[model samples]
Target: MPFGGEPPQLLKQRLLYQGRRFSFESSRLRLPNEQEGEWECIRHPGGALAVPVTPEGKLILLRQYRFTVQGRLLEFPAGTVEPSEGPEETIKREIEEETGYRAHRWRKLGEYFMAPGYSDEIIYAYLAEDLELLENPPGQDIDEDIETTLMTVEEVDRAIHSGDLADAKSISAFMLARPFLK
Candidate 1:
């Protein structure tokens, strides 16, 4: 652990709701400062993302509709880490399904927490290169409304700066893969 610390003393814990991808929980605990309170959080299986690059030096992205936000967001190909699967496996499957491309080379970017205040969702990110488009690509899930898009490195940076691409994980992962980009 990098910045390790003793966890709060848990007094009681209860599961509030269990969904397909995550669960909600409430806990009563005494903090290190000796203060006691009830806290709620979301427990997730984690997520994996791939920043796929083409031989033409363009990045593959998506305009995805998220019902919660009631709009489309620009994002990289990603999926939840399923049981018994590594992060790499999750992203590998997702990249193909979402983008219709398979990557011959991969480089691990890094992992980071999405929201510490309410959820324990860590996003494992990777840089995917040497992509080959599949003739018979596996389609996306029925519920996903996604459109594949390609952009240059500068375009992505401008989108981030202009608030056009507001997805946090996408922005973070792009910054991580930036130094290696040509």
Candidate 2:
């Protein structure tokens, strides 16, 4: 039988937990190979990210703290897709809120699965150019610990090569935006 059993049938499903950004779900399934088991995954509303490029060729990034990782990681401005917002709106709002910059030109790079192994979260990535720095940037969320910075393309590549930038979503989005980076 093919993988996923031609879209596996949902035998039973339960909501394990429901959080602000995502929910945990456990599903019991019967595979094509006659295997029956329960699989747990995170059900996220999805996310949107932007690779902001300054006119002088700098990239905007954030060193944000993640409780799960217990350290700050370099990341692009991104946000979870709110129920009333699309990916574009999410990125547009997130860029200003997180990076204090607004982009007049936007080229959608692409979308990808963030962690297919345990999450159904897909991230929509965009290339944001023609940037303008907001004089009075919006205040970040009280729960967020983020510090924004600017780096050259070469600097970002170096950071990635040296594992200083370890955000998978940012790395994947950068790869998608590579052609426009130089």
Model 1 C-alpha lDDT per residue in residues 31-134, reported as the tens digit of each score: 99999999999999999999999999999999999999999999999999999899999999999999999999999999999998999999999999999999
Deviation of model 2 at 180, angstroms: 1.2
As for candidate 1, its clashing pairs are: none
Report the poorest 10 consecutive residues by lDDT, candidate 1.
1-10
Superposed model 1: Cα runs more than 4 Å off: none
lDDT of 2 by residue, 1-182 (tens): 12342667789999989998899999999887778999999999999999999999999999999999999989999999999999999999999999999899999999999899999899999999999999998868889999999999999999999999999999999999999888
Clashing pairs in 2: none
Which candidate gets the maximum TM-score versus the true structure?
Answer: 1
Off by over 4 Å in 2: 1-5
After TM-score superposition, the amount by which residue 67's alpha carbon in candidate 2 deviates from its true location, in angstroms, is: 1.1
